[model samples]
Target: MVAAAILASAPATAALSADGGVAQPARPFQFTVIGHPFRATSDENLLRRSITEANQDKPAFIVATGIKAQTEACSDRLYAQRRDILDGSPRPLVLLPAGSDWAGCRNSAGRSNAIERLNRVREVFYPDNQSLGVRRITLTRLSANVKFRSYAENAYWEQGGVLFATLNIPDNNNHYLPEAGRNSEYEDRLVANRAWLHRLFLMAQRRNMEGLVLFTDGDIKAHVDEGFSLLSGFSAKQDGYAAVRKQVRAFAEKYQGKVLLVDSQGEPKATPAITWRGNLGRLGVGGEWETVRVQPGTASLFSLKDADSP
Candidate 1:
């Protein structure tokens, strides 16, 4: 476990600010990545314990890729419960809503509209400009000039000499549905996402950032072994996955800096699927990129060190 090294060398209290805020440490700082709770029975206790443990660890911040419930009906109560649990975390939490949270509800037995569910997600999860959790951090989202100004879920921030960005790339083939307006929505979000990627790379290049991290709820690099990727293509009108991979890869190559891709998946651990963890970071660096399987009561710890350090 990478966290073991951090625990052995660094004091647990190193990330706690004197004023009860998150400490703004120098480069080589550590943080936590939490995927989502399993889609089993509706058990909030397990999630509460995970938050408690993460708070005890005291990382600089925490990021939850997305949450999923396997129940037949997508209930608003479930979403609200998940949001409340996230807000209870003692550290700052960055959440990225994914397909399971909204997309799959479209045309389901419950007959929920995808767009409406997405709107509800934003309304409930992103009620404020600041992030969830007790420790709130202001985010830089797409301003009024952007087409999807209501998408306050996308955000970017700088930390410890690195540029961290979260995009609203849900796993449902990016909403490339055949229905009317679905294609337009997908296209618009795609354009916005592309622009976001370009801007992130530009910021890194201009600001001389040491590394860049782009995380989302969707697994852009899904392969044949992953079952979720199979379902994504059914809703795609244009080849969104290919475009995203190409653009992000090109940027990483051009930047010639360490880049990390952190995402969450809905598949349970018992299923035989592609391994979530992989080595896609700067070839020689220790912690470049990997997927964290964050279940109830468990979180992954990692540090962002200068590319050439260690």
Candidate 2:
């Protein structure tokens, strides 16, 4: 099923309450996703304006997949600057790290340390159990208990009968350290991420969430506009990437509800937003699988209202 089919399956708005009063289930609300915002003097104005607009729009929340520095390599200063940008938002904000932010900066001129930079990101952006921005929501983090507990960046929260989650799944094959001895750290995170993901599905099931949204910095879907291939770096053989995608497909199929897989960075498969709104094509997934493309200045707006509603 494509987006149209999913829309077609939606139940129409119910009429007035048993009495004459209006019977309202919660109103459909929207949130914003800002992909990679590579900051520079030229982009300062645009970034500020986008935040202002999002604040005015008053989304239930806002999330930035990651922030990138124009020419400068990743550094603590850059991460702090990005944090300030996120904190400036008047609405709740959740920031997830992208490859450019850390993993890809391993050999930068700034003597960047991927691990330390990531730690700073979690420090400044995720200082508390609550989210950033003026309006905050407490999120369940995977770091609360575990050996790799500092990775509090993987977070989840529920809104409007939907469970939303963010994973630190960046590009570069999820930092799959292929070196013989350097693989331990990568392996640890892989295990932790999977556990968090499984827990998310379990919680969503227990809560009877109407839908689930999984957001990451990398495009995890199997197919792109050109057709499915391994070059996208999300091939079935890639360690962390493929495992998460398989798990997502399984849960989406079992839930039989809307499941939106959003990736911040990538050449969009369909459109900048709502890439391919249809069934999880090859996996035979049961839910309405929608892929949204969210990048700086391009925000997807959705409303819960029926187009033909009175």
lDDT per residue for candidate 2 within 1-310, as digits (tens), equals 1111112122233436689785544345667666565523335455566567656656778777656653555667766776777787888988777776777566535553777767767787777789887778899888887665888989999875567888888766787765577656577777888788788878876755556677777767643333444345555554546666667667766764456666655333332334443433221111112222111111222212232235
RMSD of 2: 7.5
TM-score of 2: 0.75
lDDT of 1: 0.60
The number of clashing residue pairs in each candidate reads 0, 3
Q: Give the Cα-based TM-score of candidate 1 against the true structure.
A: 0.71
TM-score of each: 0.71, 0.75
Which candidate gets the maximum TM-score versus the true structure?
2
RMSD in Å for all candidates: 9.0, 7.5
